[model samples]
Target chain A: MIKWVDVYKAFGEKKVLDGFTLDVHEGEAVVIIGYSGAGKSVAIKHVVGLLEPDRGTVEVDDNDVPTLPRKELYELRAHIGYVFQFAALFDSMTIGDNVAMGLRKRGEMSESDIAHRVAEALELVDLPDVQHQYPAELSGGMRKRVGIARAVALRPKYILYDEPTTGLDPVTSAVIDELMIRMREKLGVTSVVITHDMRSAYRVGSRIAMLYDGRVRQVGTVEEIQHTKDPIVRQFIEGRATLEGDAASLAAPGPAFESGATARGGGAE
Target chain B: MNVIEATGRWVRFRVEEAGRAGRFLEEAALAFGSVRSWLPNATLQMRRLGVDSLPIGLLIAVFTGIVLALLASYSFTGAVPLYFVGTLVEKTITLELAPVLTGLALAGRVGANIAAELGTMRVTEQVDALETLAYDPDSYLVVPRVVAGTIMFPLIVGVAMIVGLGAGWLASIGLLHLSSDEFLKGARMFFSTFDVEYGLVKAGSFGFAVTLIGCYKGLRARGGAEGVGNAATQAVVYSAVMILVLDAFWAMTWLHGRS
Candidate 1:
């Protein structure tokens, strides 16, 4: 289980996360959807021990992630897999070498075992033939697949995906979504996917959380989220938040009353 | 007044940068509590920073040796007694060529590669990924490069010195018709172990300067493609300039020590 308790993050003067809390139950696949700076990325970072909260605790399996000792923390992280937005493939190494990197760090795996596991991970991602190719030689989609292979190669119990489908075509997006679903079903992995694509969220999310203004606006099952009567949730899900008087009010700047008047004016009749 | 303030600001900045570097290493130690893993990371990074760099470093080493020989022979022709031959040759390579050429060669090779890799990782958010994974990016990234530069630099300079000596010997004996024994004897008298040590120390320091600057610039890189290009260029240019300034300071200090 992963839990965020009243997390607060600020960079200089800008508050990126403010007293946010969300719990992802064991075996749950939660997809976080939000605007770019809405702090969805920051929120997941807390889950995996990336960024600690200023005044809150991030617990992974009831153990405080941020406060864990270095040795304990690295051990805890060994069970988690993170895929970067750009795939974050080591450009200098061959595909097999990149896949073997994390395992090699653990310092117990034999060369043959590393090779066998890398091959298996790549096979799971449908990229078995790309083991020898460098990242520069592969297409973007292929590179992301290799990234996924590397992440899964570690056999992590928890997998965190940061914008896995961004910049990918719809077909590629669907492929990744299926892979995400398949991993949870096959490996029983607890997954957290942070993305802005509502379609992806709907496809992979058992529980969908929408982050707004550095807080989780709502977290629920896909059916509950889609059919909810909440205006903010509806506006966001439909990609028509621009029509909200709230959005207009926020986007426009002035004294509160004048901005309210403009927001009201801008709203659809 | 502004100029004085600016100069003061520059000095203060260097001091702060040094302090930050110290703190960064301390945090890195905390992050990498396992000395076992840390050593391997350093070794893997060292191999990449050194062995991978050998081919390119050797190319510069060879050419730099040949150039020193050629230039000195040309300029010193008929102007000085032949007994001065080894003194000039030894001083040129030991004091200047070994260290300068090593830095120059790496500015084009290791420095550029470090900037490019770090810059790309920065842009792609890989370093951020490492941090998110609870790994200190500086430890995983910069420490290895620093170690490689510090260790491999001396080795690289040694190669440059040997090649330079051989090339100078050939140019003097084979090309310039100088007596082989006199040229060889001049070298034996003027070449001291201390000179080589001085050159090696200079190489190590220069290596640290270039790698840190390259890694720092790269780790902080933003914007996009143009940003990375700018970073690579700045790393090379600044490292080269710092190498000269540091070389001059070392020279004055060494000269003082001898006197």
Candidate 2:
């Protein structure tokens, strides 16, 4: 399980996360939906110790992520897979090498075994016969699939996806949605995904959480989020412009999502 | 008050940058413990940064040699003997020009290459991906480039010196109408082993500083393409400045009493 407790992070007078809290249980997919710059990515980065919180603790399993020693943190990271928003493939390396990089770092597998695993991961993502190709040679969607393949090849217990379908076409988005579902079904891997794509959220998420004013405003099953009465959640999920009296409120920027917002049983999961 | 505020901000920024660089250096030094992780990568970096840079180094050396020979002949027309052309060319090339010029040239090429490549990787999140894979990016990315630069700078400078001397010898014979024996005699007259040692030390220091600054700027690059471009520019500029500084440092430290 991954737990972020009352995390408060700020950068030069701009607070990105304010009392932000969430938890991911095993064997389920939790999708975080929010506006741009709402600290969705920042919240997820805390899980991998990429960003340390100013006044909170991020726990992976029972281990405190922020306080873990360097060797321990690296050991903890080995069990988690993180898929970047941009695929983040190594431009200089071949697709096969990118997929095999993590396994090679562990230095426990034989060369043939690593090759076999790389090929298997690529096959799982439906990318075959492209191992020799560089990332720059691949299409954006294909590069994303390779990114997924790279993460899945590690067989990590948890996978974190950062805007997995942000830039892809609708058909490509559906393909990725299916891949996320397949990973859950086949490997039973726990996942935490950040996306603004409502269709993707409804499809892949077992539970959905909406972030507002740097904190989760509502979190529930898909049905609860879809039928939410909260005007902020409704405006966001329906892709509306602004809430009632929101234009003036946005100018002054007071506390947001405070009224008519339901935290649904007062729990993140 | 406004001027004071701006000056304070600039000073704070430089202090923060110095702190970051110090931390990065400490981490890089720690990464040297993992020899297996960086050795192969260092070998690849050496070939890419050093061997492949030979043509440009030689090209700069050739032109510099010809210019030095011509200038020496022009200056030594009257009371000064023509053989001093070879002596001047030899001393200048070996003691100063070969290391400083070659360093500045490679600083532009090697420093910019390291910065641009690593900056692209940073902006694209490849470095983050490396971390996710449980790899220390300092060991994998920084150590190899720095190792390559430190080991190869002196070697490239040595080769450039030889090529430069040969070019000067040819120019003295062809353009200055001086005998080969006179040129060789003048060249050997004022030569000292310390000159060559000082030049190589400067070259090695240049190599280390250039690549270190490149890696420092590159890894810290944020945003997108513009950030990468800025990092590359800073890498080259800082490297050139650092080379000149190190040159003066070595000259004072090594040549203070002897001269």
Candidate 3:
């Protein structure tokens, strides 16, 4: 299980996450949805020890992520896979090498074993027989699949996807969504996907969590989130702008809203 | 801002930058504790940073040798023997020109390339990807380049020294109207093994500085294309400036008591 408890993180004056909290139990997919710059990515980054929360705890299997020693952190990370938004493929390396990176780092597998696993992972992502190609030669969708292949090459127990389908065409996005679902079902891996695409959230998420104004606004199944009565939730899902009076009221001075107000005021002046 | 406030900000920026550089160096040193994973990359970088640089380095050394010989001939007009021009060329190339000039040239070539490559990776999140993959970015990305630079520079400088002396001898014999025997005698007159060793030491130190500064600038790059461009430019400029500074310091300290 992965749990973020009252996570507070700020970059300069911009409080990206304030008392944000969420939990993902074993063997389930929980997609966190939020608008751009809403800290969805930041929240997932904490799970992988990529970013540390300033004032709260991030725990994976009850191991404190931020305070873990280097060796222990690396050991923990070996069991988790992170897929980046841009694929983040090592351009200089061949696709095969890119997929094999994590496996090679473990230093326990033979060369032929690593090669066999790379082929298997690529086949799982439906990207068979492009091992010799470089990332620059692959299409965006293919690169994203290669990124996924790289992540799953180690057969990690958990996978974190950061905006996995953000820039791809709708058809390609659907393909990626299907791959995410398939990976979870087949591997029994706990999955956390961070994305703003509502369609993708509904497609891949067993449960959807909405992040807003620095904290989780709601957590529910896809059907529950679609019919949620909360105006903020409704406004986001419907992609509708807040009415002027409602916007002003929502922006009113309050402790829960202080960071947003300060950030906007500072940006304006 | 007021003048005092501006000065304070500048000081703070410099101090912060120094602290960052210190920390980066520490991490790079720690990376050496795990050299097995980085060895293959280090060899590949040696080809890129050292082997590919050979022709340009040699060309520069040859021309510098001819120029130094020509200038020395002008100084040896009447009283001094024309052959001493050979000694001057030999000593100057071995002690100063070959290593220092080669380092400056590579600061522009290798340093800029390292910075640009790493800066692009930073912007594209490749370094973050490595970290996420449970790989140490310092060991995987940085140590290889630094190790290549430190190891290859002296070898490059050795080639530069030999080619430079040979070109200087040819130039002296042809342009200065001196015999081969006279030039060879002058070249061998005051040859000390120490001068060559000191030059290689300088070469190695300069290589480390160039690569470390390049990696530092690249890794710290933020924003986007503009930041990458800035990092590349700063890598070359800073590496060159540091090479000159190290040159002066080496002269004062390493060569002071011995000379």
RMSD, candidate 1, Å: 5.0
Error of 3 at B74 (Å): 0.7
- Each candidate: what lDDT? 0.79, 0.91, 0.90
Task: Give stretches of model 2 more than 4 Å off.
Answer: A244-269
lDDT of 1 by residue, A63-175 (tens): 89989976688788878899878898878789999888888877779999999999999998888898888999998888888888888888888999989999999999999
For all predictions, the C-alpha RMSD in Å is: 5.0, 4.0, 4.4
Tens digits of per-residue lDDT for model 3, B64-90: 999999998888776788788778988
Error of 3 at A140 (Å): 0.7
Question: Which clashing pairs does model 3 show?
Answer: none
User: Is model 1 an incorrect, acceptable, medium or high docking prediction?
Assistant: acceptable
Task: Show model 1 residue runs off by greater than 4 Å.
Answer: A244-269, B1-19, B27-80, B130-139, B174-176, B252-255
- Going through the candidates in order, their DockQ values are 0.38, 0.81, 0.81
Worst 10 residues of 3 chain B by lDDT: B76-85
> What ordering of candidates by TM-score runs from best to worst?
3, 2, 1
Give the CA lDDT, 0 to 100, for residue B144 in model 2: 97
Q: Please compute the TM-score of chain B alone for each predicted structure, in the order given.
A: 0.84, 0.98, 0.98
Every model's TM-score: 0.83, 0.94, 0.94
